[model samples]
Target: MDTEAHVTERDRSSDPDTREGEGSRSARFLDAPWRRPALLGTACAAFLLLFSTFVMQPFLIPSGSMEPTLRVGDRVLVNKLAYRFDSVPQRGDVVVFDGTGSFVREEPAGNPVTGLVRWAAAAVGLAEPAETDYIKRVVGVGGDRVVCCDKRGRVEVNGRAVDETYLYPGDVPSRVPFDIVVPQGTLWVMGDHRSHSRDSRDHLGEPGGGMVPVGKVVGRADWIGWPVGRWSSLERPDAFGRVTAPGPVGSHG
Candidate 1:
């Protein structure tokens, strides 16, 4: 009788339904009310982080340089892959790029924690972009001759005048006249709000001769994504259509 009783107890312990009940109690301990929401929040954050890093990134306009097109406090979507696959920036395209060693002679250094905080803020358009990032419109590409204020008071590309209807009202193409032949694999960029912009014109005497390298380009601004009322797709202006391919090096326009 004692042996039979012990066997019965052991069989009950080994039964599948009994084991399942024990497992259910263990799962119940972890199924707290807060767990689901916390898990969901974590998942959403990770998705947004990935999306921002690899796909389209949102950049906040911090200056009036691109006025009449991109206003201060506006959020623009930068297409990071625009030039990644053997493509290059075209004239009249608005682009974002890291300016270290080009637009900026020195790269700023900061503490890790502060950098992290600023990065977080900039990622969501709450803070201005870092000192290294700049936005401007391409005016001349490699081999192009860019001359400011032709006989008609307009900027010229390869000896052709550009009708810049997009310029800020009453703003001239450039107050300071300039003539430059863009070197190969670089670009000459400028701002629509010429008076307020410190672009290639301002860095003419610096190294690289005010030309932004093609490799340093971050992406093209494809759209204004925030401030719903101001949202619109960015298109290349037709003013550049009349410009011809750049002449050979040393050829005067």
Candidate 2:
């Protein structure tokens, strides 16, 4: 009698209705209107965070420094893999870079946790760009001589004058004159609006000679991703075609 009683209790506990009832209750709990949507939203955010971190990043233009090339409120899509494989930054290519030692003295101190969140937010174009981030056109590359204002008041690279039609209207190539050779593995960058930009020319007196190390480059600005009216690619200027590579033969090799 005792054995029969125990078996009857065990069978009741293992009933399909009992197990299914527990599972259904759990499912209902998870299916709360807010909870399901919240879960999906979190999954989407995580995907964007990863994609923006390693693939491409949307950088917001904070000011008019880039002017005609990149206007205020423009979200430039930085191609992170542009130079990741075997390529290097070339003259006339607009690039986004971290200017820690080149532009800013040092990185700002911040809590690591907060900083990570802020950086992730900026990566996906959800927040403002970091203060140390900068975007500019490559005027001179490694081993090239960069000079401001030739006889025609145009910037010169490798002894050839560059016709900058992209310059902000009425804005000169550079208001402050400078002449320097770009260091190997570094880049001399400038903004389209030379008058208002504080670019490599502005940092000529400081260390690195206003040159941004190629290693600091985040990526080339491939396209304008935001503002439906301003959707277009940032093409490399043909003016650089005339300028030869630093070495002999006047070739791109």
Best by TM-score: 2
Collision count for each candidate, in order: 0, 0
Candidate 2 residue-wise lDDT at 193? 91
Q: How well is each residue in 154-173 modelled by candidate 1, as lDDT tens digits?
A: 99999999999889999999
Q: What is the lDDT of residue 54 in candidate 2?
A: 84
Q: Report residue 146 deviation for candidate 2 (angstroms).
A: 0.8
Best by lDDT: 1
Tell me how candidate 1 scores on lDDT.
Answer: 0.90
TM-score for each candidate, following the candidate numbering: 0.87, 0.88
Local distance difference test scores for all models: 0.90, 0.89
Q: Candidate 1 clashing pairs? A: none
Tens-place lDDT digits, model 2, residues 151-205: 8898888788999999999999988888788888999999999889999988888
Clashing pairs in 2: none
User: Superposing all C-alpha atoms, what RMSD in Å does each candidate have to the true structure?
Assistant: 4.3, 3.9
